[model samples]
Structures are given as structure tokens and as C-alpha cells.
Target: MKNITCLLASILLAIVVQAQELKLKPRKADALGGTAFAHSISDSTLSLVAREEIIFREIKNGNVPSFLRKFQKIVSKATIDNKDYELVFFVLPDYLAIGHNDDYFYMPMTPILAQKVANLLHCSLPTRKITDLIDQNATLKLTPQPIPPSKAMTTVPVFITHNDLVKQQMQPYLSQHANGALTVGNKKDIVISNKIYGETTPRVVIYGWHQLDGKPIQPLYNKHTNTWADYSHGVRLVQNTMWLNGKKTTLAKILADPLLSQLLSDEGIIEKSYYPVFDNY
Candidate 1:
């Protein structure tokens, strides 16, 4: 009876742990953002960054294995510290799991996996207390703490802003999340595109983000200024605006194009966002 009870408790704990899902937000290739821990930099971040460099080197070395060869387009170069750099680091495993409602990929935080990642990248481990960032994030302010001397390994989330593939994954949730509705904060006008509504015409749906008391975020539009501002720039939306091909196109226009629309509406992409990502069974 004692053994059985212990087993049952263990199973229950596993179930609870498995129930936690990691969600990533949508980010475009050109989207700009940073993810530095308040305390000291974590080992996972260094490992991830170093691994990225290795991946770049592999492609450059021209001895990339067959499996990696197939990913030539993605494994092209390493420009992390460069300007034309388009990818933004979103999540670093030490405190949180930053992902999107769409099909965002996650890197597991197992001891062996984490250690191997560090070894392969030749980076030092992030000190302890890195996981304590949750305390600071609760206040939604920057107050990073350094990791102390400890042997415990931690998993945290890092958001990497890069590529349309990631943005598509983040779309359904960012634009129309069911549980947590998107609330626009302060701003003059909110310009929505057909991309969010699955339409075409370069049409701009302008809306206001500011509200008094309990009033809802209202929509605003004007024909005079081609600029459809919303949520006072960064304060409103959590991520950077999608600048498709460096051209600031409207939402309606993107929807109008059959090619763009089809890419956005791919069944494989949509299903991943709708269903549980890690549920392979």
C-alpha cells in the first residue's frame, strides 16, 4: 500500500507538470527586441547564442551533414552581432518559456540536454537565481538578478524575433486569443490590416488604444494621413510590427494577394497553433 501510494503521487506530479504549456508570441524577421536577464546572463542564453554561431560555422565550413544540408537556406550565415541582423532573441531557458499561440518551437530543459548544449557551444553556465526572474516579471519591470553558485539547472523562456514562419505561428493568438483578449493600451490610432482578418485590399482599419475608466479600446480611421498609428508604438502591442519585405504595406493588401493569403492560411500551420504543440501522440 505504501509503495502504491508513492507511485500514485509521482504519477500525479508528472501529470501536473505535463499540463504546463509553453506559448510563444508572433515575431517577424525584421522585428527588433532584446531578451537579457535582469540578474547575470544565464548559461542557457550563452549556449544558445554559441550554438547559433556553430550552426553558422557548419554551413560555412561546407562539411555540414546531410540532414543539416537540407536546411541550407536557414543555415546560411552568422550575423548575431551585426546590424543587418534580423533575428531577435526571444526566450532563453532559465526562467520562462516564451513562445506563441502559433507553432512555436521549444528547446527542452533536461539536465543532459542542457549540459550537452553548453558543452557543444563551449559557453559557461548561467549562475543560479536566474529562475528567480519570475518574481520580477510578475511586476512587469526590469529587475534581473544574477545566478548564485549552485548545481541546480533551470529552464527559462527566450523570445527570438525572426522570420515570417514564426510570425504566422504567433498570428492567431496575438490577433484573436480566446482566453487572454488583446487589450490595446494608450495611443492615438490603431490601424489594422486585412492580414489579421484574412482579407485583401491594402485596407487600413484604424483604432484607438486609450480608454477612460472601463471603456473599451475603440477603432479610429482617417483618410488624410496614410499613417495609421495605434497603441502609442511599443506600449500597445507586445511585439514589433510586421514590415513585409521592408515595405510598410497595409493589412488589406496582403490579404488581397492570393499567394500571400495561401501561405498565411496553410492548414499545417493553422492546426499546430490550434492544437497542443508537444502532444505528439
Candidate 2:
């Protein structure tokens, strides 16, 4: 009995140590953005549509916050069919934000705009498995902040309010990762799902917003139209190019691979990786 107890303790200790050793470094995205675009959410006359245009314009001109320029390296290791594989990818340290670091607002956009921004930045949206991998390896995690449902949920004021709430939740760690480190939780990700394939109706698929204990508040869902976006929704850009088994490859190739797609997608393969672009946004 004593020998069995000792063996169980040893296994527990190993698991604890492995969890404690999880850490990641920022991959410098110096060329991404440094120009600061200062915008105020207090503008009541500006409609959400107008605000979205301004957000896109600034980002297109490379006027995003300095912190977002830092991509964090996320590594995932898996063993399938008795073969070991490791995939390394980089992601923006946090959700896509607008304006200066001190005055930024986490911008929520329709899937159309999200796709446009992703294309402009040479980035891609995360999959369900990718979201889980990122959350599991995130340097810091926070509780999800959800506002009461209302028409204003898609407005800028509510968006700023939720952003501020998230800031408060992450306040204690601000000093260590001033510009917003690789963080998980706080917003539901606009992800690529297999459901989007061959659907006659355009829809938005979202997942994530994990709690501190790593349980996700939102499950894989696509009930909303593609153009619908709310304060709780956030867009995270993943670097298109990733390292697959030590060889640099594109997410396009990896996601379309027969077996390798499992690393980044839970629901089989993601053939239609992006939402159809709408110019009206």
C-alpha cells in the first residue's frame, strides 16, 4: 500500500511540475504596427458602422497599438497513431484592438470586416482546437465578462464598457505585460468552423471565452448571421505561417492536411477557411 501511494504521489508531482513550467515568449512583429491612432468612443454621433470604417482605415494605415505588434509563440504537441508531432504558431498577443495602448478599445466587427482585416494583416482566424490550444498555453487568463443582452450590445459604448471590465480583471498583471500579453478569456473568438462549409446562408461561427479554471463559457455556435457582431465578440489574428514539425509552413497547408488539421481544428478539416467578404462593412 505504501509503494502504491508513493507511485501516485510521483505521478501527481510530475503533472503539477509540467503545468507550472508552461511559458511562452513574444515573437517580435516589429513591422506590423507602431503608428498610434487615437479615437474616442465617447462620440455619440458616430454610429457603429461609421466607427468600424474608421477602425479599418487606421489599421490599414498601420495605426494599431504597439503591444499588438508583438506576437506570442504558441506551441502544441500531440501524439496520434503512435507518431509524435509538434506544431508552433504565433498569434497577436491579444484580441484585435484599436487606438493607443492606454486608450484602446477591443474592436468587435462583423465576420466580413474580420476577414478583411485578417487578409490585410496576412493573418487568419483561429479554429476551435486552436482556441483551446492557445487558452491552454496562455501566459495569463481572465474570467469572461458578459453584459446583459440588448440592442446596444453591438454598439461602441457597450464595447468599451466590456473592454474596461476586462482591463480591470487583468489589472494585477498590467505591470508585467504592460501592452497586453498573450491573454486568454474575456472575449468569444470568431473562429472557422466546418459548419460554414457549403451553407447557403452566411453565418458567423464563434467559440472560446474560457473561465479561470479553463472551462469555456461559449461553445461552438453559429446561430448568428455573418454580419452580426456584439460586444462580447472579439477578433484574434493568427499568423498565417506556422512551424509544422520544425518545418515552416502555412496554416492553409496545415489546416487542409488530412491528419495535421487535428492540431488546429477539432471538427474534421476546415476547407472553407474564411467568411465571404462583404464590401459594405
Candidate 3:
């Protein structure tokens, strides 16, 4: 009887642990989502600094792409410390974008804003190990299209251009995913790592713009300042919730654990796995 009861409980726990979904907080009524807001800014003559501020504010107040609300679940299982472990977690189906309804554009921001958005949505950036896992398991893999780097890469015009390019790339997939799907390889991801823990000046760590061959173009690099956001950068949020060995856990907690940290981190224990969110980076 005891063994039978344990088996039933295990089955019930497995059912509950599968593919959890996370929804973003509700936006205010009549408030603009990511759609009208991004288009308006592209046509305006606002300075780059001004545009970034408003973009951050709009996102903070919940003006994000509607598709972002439906977080996609990803599961990873592995053996660490001579024990098998399974991790199930939720992530944004698409890279963070700004829009409402069916209209939206993927937006890139500095690590400062990325961390702030993660905090707002109760999500965190991915580690290198998880970044690779997402790419490997994503349903759609878009070829990365990197615009030539220039000073204007940080400008709104480039952002709009990149958005159009990405939309064009997605046209063939629209029949399958009208709004979005679990996608990867289109842009370099803003990631969390122990690399930033001791940097003299705060730096943004980016990785993973994989090719059709499944090889990444960028490496785990942190030379860029947290304030330097380019057109190629993307923010994909991973929900803080993590299921470890069929029990409720979090990235911060598991990452701090020496043994379980092997599941998601390539750099060993990442006790501090996120950037410090701040007004000035």
C-alpha cells in the first residue's frame, strides 16, 4: 500500500510539472501596447536618448507585444553529480517585442532595460547552457541576419529596419504561427553569467546567434557596456520558476546549488545570475 501510494503521488506530480504556462501582468485599459507606440516613435524626431527612455517606460508600464503573454514551456533533463534531474521552465515564445494585437516589432535594449523588464515580468535572462538548450529545442530556427555595424545601430531607424527584416524572414512561417512561435537564432541573446560579477564597469554579456548549421556566431562576451544596445541584440525572458527533479524551484536557487547548477550553467555556480537593474547603467 505504501509503495502504491508513492507511485500515484509521483504520477500526479509529473502531470502537474509538465509544460507550465506564464502570463504577463495585465495592461491598463485603453493603454497602448507595443504596436502604435513603436511606429509613432520611428516617425518622430526624438533624440536617441529620449526614445530609449520612452521605450523603457512603455515596456515597464506593460506596453509589450501581446504574443509575449503566452510563455512557452521548455524541459531539460540531465545527469549531474551522479543523479538524474529534470528541469521544466517557461520562456517567452518570441524575443521581446513591442506591439499590440497582431502588430509588433522585436525590440533590442541595453542590459539595463532587459534586466528591468525581466524583474517586471518575474523572469530572468538565460545562462549559456540554457541558451543552447532553447536553440536546440526551438520549433522554429530563423537564420540570423546581422546588419552592418555602425554608430546608427543604436538608433530607432535601424531598429525599424531590423524588425522589417525579421518579419520578412517570418513570412514563410506565418501559416503555422500567425502571431509567433518558439523561435531561435534570429538575434544575439542578452544573457546572465558570473562573468559580470566582478567587472570594474558593468558590462552586458551576450551570446547565441546560431546559424543554420547550429553553430553560434557570437561567443560569451562581456566587453560591451550595459548601456550599449545594438540592432542585433534581443531580450528573451525565462520565467524564474524552475522544476528541479519534479519539485518547485527557481533559477537563483538552483544556480546557487553547486550540484544542480550543472543543469543550467556552463560556468559552474552562478550565485548572482542577473544584472543589477538600475536607471543609470
Candidate 4:
């Protein structure tokens, strides 16, 4: 009896360790600004749908005539049993665009991708469970509706600072906008990009998401400091913002910044701008 108790404890410990070690880094955002992430039932989880394709220029002209048929077979095999992974094809004309009956990552149904996925899953046996879950629970588990900007009175300011690596990453997007303005109601926001000023110069961007709208809206990210005013019901409110290095706290601090709270209460931007002074180490 004691040996059995010890064995049970060991099994419990193993499960605890496995749960602690589970981690996933979301895939970088796709062209549409959507990042791919996932949750799983076990360590042995397999991707349900994956998009695999060869570019035309990557293949010989004559190869397309023969390779096209092979591509069809690959898709057919991939879709069987509602393969769980999703594949997005950029190819035009005959590109298999979406999934058919598969439990794909993004919940919304894209007919092209969906039909292709259905075709592929029609042949696989192992993926049937995912397909069945998708059929039964899809309505509940599919993509969540976005929250409207007006209702999101609680604005979270995420200030990314002191990271040369991250600034280098955002340069491309900033160059495109170059102070281009995006307006939400009476408020107009600008996009700023830079290559220099690693210290204290934090870039900022705002994302307005709507729960009922899944449209991709541009989100601003920056390293240097910037400011904006909040006006509601014909009143102007002001706020000074800064970065707090605590890993997951940026989102909350921005919304509740003292300056923002005061501005909203006062009904206007501050007559005197307050710089969030940070001490250097």
C-alpha cells in the first residue's frame, strides 16, 4: 500500500512538471496583422492545418504542368479527417485558399480556404476528432468578436522602451505611414518611426478594437514618448504617459495614468504638459 501511494505521488509530480513547462510563442503576425497562436490538449498535439506551397518562379515553367497535379494530391491528403492545421495560399487562380471542414486556427469561415481544407480532410482518418470538435463546438470556440472603439473607454497604453532590437523591427511599418493620420471620431493619431534614440525616446501606437467587428485596424507601437488627449461628451481630458518595465503591467498603467484620469475629469488637455520623468540608473 505504501509503494502504491509513492507511485501515485510520482505520477502527480510528473503531471505538475509537464504543465509548468508548457509554453508557446505566437507566430509573427501575418500580412493581415493576425498572429497565429494555439492551445493544446497534450504535448503530442499536431498542427491541424498547414499551408504548403511552391512559388511559380521557384519551379521550372514545365514543372508547373506536372507539379499542379501533385499539389492537388497533397491538398487532398492534408484535408482528410479534417486535418487540424490551416494553410493560407497566396497563389492566384487555382490556389487552395482556405480550409473545408477542419478545426482551423482562425475561427471565421473563409470559403476558399474552407473548401480547400474540406477537400484535404476528406481523406485523413486521424484528424476526425478535430473535425468533429469543430463541427460541434466551433460556434462556441471560434474567433471572438472584436470590441468597439467607443465602448473601449478603458484604453491601455503599452509603452515599449529601451529595446534597440524591437525598434529595428518596427521601422518598416513607420516608414510606410510617415506621420500618416488615422482618425477615430474627432481624434486623429499619427504613426512615427525612427532608427536612432535608444534611450527615453519611446514610440507609441494605439489599437482600437471592436468586439463585434473583426476588421484589421492599424495599431501603433513606438519607443519614444508621445501624448494624446481624451475628449468625451464635449469635454477634453489630458494625460501624461510613461513606460513601466514590469513585464505584464504596461497595459493597465496606460489606461489608468494619473494624467489621463485628471484630463478626463477636467474635460481638456493639460495647459502645461507634464513629462514623465524617469531616473537613469
Q: Best candidate per TM-score, number?
A: 3
Error of 2 at 211 (Å): 0.4
Per-residue lDDT tens digits for candidate 2, residues 1-281, read 97898687657544532332112223234423212232354476876567668777767765556667767778878887899988877877788876555556677888888988988877889998888888987887887878889988877667767877887787788754555467888798999888655567788998989998888889998888887888888899887877666566888887888898888878877878888886654
Better of 3 and 4 by TM-score: 3
What are the lDDT scores of the predictions, listed in order? 0.26, 0.75, 0.79, 0.21
- TM-score of each model, paired residue for residue: 0.18, 0.82, 0.88, 0.16
Clashes of each: 46, 0, 4, 49
Give the Å error, residue 114, model 1: 36
Better of 2 and 3 by TM-score: 3
At residue 256, what lDDT does model 2 achieve? 87
Put down candidate 3 lDDT per residue, 1-281, tens digits, no spaces.
Answer: 97898688679666764544444556666666454666777754776566677777777777665566776767788886677888888788778876664567788888888887788778899998888888887888999999988888887778878888888888888744545478887789999998776778888999999887789999999998877888899998999987775677899998999888878888999988889776533
> Where is model 2 poorest over a 10-residue stretch in terms of lDDT?
19-28
Each prediction's Cα RMSD? Answer: 22.3, 8.9, 2.6, 25.9
On lDDT, the candidate that comes out on top is: 3
Query: Which of candidates 2 and 3 reaches a greater lDDT?
Result: 3
Q: lDDT of candidate 1 vs native?
A: 0.26
